[model samples]
Target chain A: AQSVTQPDARVTVSEGASLQLRCKYSYSGTPYLFWYVQYPRQGLQLLLKYYSGDPVVQGVNGFEAEFSKSNSSFHLRKASVHWSDSAVYFCVLSALTNSAGNKLTFGIGTRVLVRP
Target chain B: GPKVLQIPSHQIIDMGQMVTLNCDPVSNHLYFYWYKQILGQQMEFLVNFYNGKVMEKSKLFKDQFSVERPDGSYFTLKIQPTALEDSAVYFCASSLYGGTYAEQFFGPGTRLTVL
Candidate 1:
């Protein structure tokens, strides 16, 4: 079974500070990775996704992530986080096949608190 | 913005009662899914439906849990004999396409509390 691991459970940063939330996955073959953000009382929104080509992918609201195959990591980064960026971020991994069931396995999620 | 909507944002029910959660996916979406999240845990995939049938379901989808889209209009999750462990935020998500690497749009979620 494919699994994801987010080492940090919570992270805090001041407004306008750079932030990076770590994510690691364990899968044998090529993996489809994704980053999602959830605001309080809101649904989870897609931040970005990585299939194969580019190692670095940009997302909305100035969010981006780099896929490292050797490291088995796909970490989310933001140059400057605003107060509104404070939310729960999740890293998910899914198999890259049509017959693999297309189920996403999620990390425990890292809570980001941007203090102004 | 095109978004999914979940009805009864919060539902409080006693144990052994049956509860049905409704979800309206994106108007043009073709794939629908259900996910569950405990207060402080990761969102776990429960099931996925497409073409009027179940595609895949995780182990977390208990025997008491069932999903249906009778008329291809509203996606529903029904839980019979709700258990205390069932108390969590139930999220409904949909994707325009069900192929690999497609991003899913999620609903605001329904908080189910079984007392």
Candidate 2:
């Protein structure tokens, strides 16, 4: 079984400030990680995904995440956030096996508020 | 980017009644999925369908829950004798393939309120 943990339930950052959201996963084997964001009344949109190779992956809207194998973490970061960046972000985990069928296990999600 | 569409953005139904949630996935996608999210909780996977069969289902998929995509039409999730606990936002997602790297596009979600 795979699971994800987002320690921060909420985060408040001023617009144009740097933002980082922490995510940790519990999985023994190599895992495929993803960051998804949900705007108000909208469906989740993919921020980025990590499978292998480079630890740092860039996503849309100037968002990026670094995958740390030793720390078992994949944290999302943005150098500058806009007011529209206020949304709920989820960290998801998927096992490498086909038997799991790529079903995603999600964290409790971190709600970010970008104050102007 | 491809888009998935879900019908009935919001639905209100009485407990013990039957309800069906509809999803129209990306035109060429081969896999469809359903997930549930209660108020202030993480979204959990319910089931995945492909090739006219259920590929995977989580324990959260209750016995009363059923899914089907007839003749490549809308992928539907039907629940019989709905309970209050079943009241939640159901999201429909679809992917071009079923694998580790497939990206699943999601619909805006259907919010079901059972009273």
Candidate 3:
């Protein structure tokens, strides 16, 4: 079955420091990957998505992700962390399990906390 | 940017009761979807609707569950005889199209609590 795994349940980083969140996926075919962030009491926001082209894709808020089919991973990274960046990040795999254009399978989610 | 809006941010109901969750999708969106997120668990897809009909649904979308967009209005997910397990955040999403090249817009989600 197709699935997404965010191994890190929680991460702590100092403001202004760099950050990286790990994600691994299991799928049989070419995968469409996405990163999403959710602030408290807010809806899930798209960060970036990897469809096919370049191995590295840039998202909003200076966030970027590298997709590696060999490793079956699409990890999210940021050059500088901000307190506002502290949120729950989810890695999703887009599969056409249904007719839904976005039949997404999400990871458990990694919660990031930025410390001042 | 386009946005999806879910009605009744919160709802408390007794088990076995019927409930409807409403979603106002992007004005021009053609595909609509519903997902369930249990606390501390990953969000799971429920069903997707288009042209007033259900195009696809996951196993989690039980037989008691139904989705429709009546007269090109709000897309709605109705659960007949709700179960306690149905207590979760139901997120409504829509995209101009389904498949690659379409970015899905999501709502804030409606929290459903069952007693």
Global Cα lDDT for candidate 2: 0.92
Runs of candidate 3 exceeding 4 Å displacement: A98-100
Shift in Å, residue B5, candidate 1: 0.5
Off by over 4 Å in 1: A96-101
Query: Comparing only chain A of model 1 with the true chain A, what is the TM-score?
Result: 0.95
TM-score of each: 0.95, 0.97, 0.96
Every prediction's TM-score for the first chain?
0.95, 0.95, 0.96
The digit string of per-residue lDDT tens for model 2 on B1-115 reads: 6788899999999999999999999999888999999998889999988889998888989999999999999999999989999999999999887787788889999999999
lDDT per residue for candidate 2 within A11-85, as digits (tens), equals: 999999999999999999888999999998878899999999999999999999999999999999999999999
lDDT (tens digit, per residue) of candidate 1 on B1-22: 6789999999999999999999
Tens digit per residue, CA lDDT, model 3, B1-115: 6778899899999999999999998899999999999998889989888777788888899999998898888899899999999999999989898885467888999999999
Please say which candidate is ahead in DockQ: 1 or 3. Answer: 3
Candidate achieving the largest lDDT: 2
Candidate 2 CAPRI grade: medium
Candidate 3: pairs in clash: A101-B99
lDDT of 1: 0.91
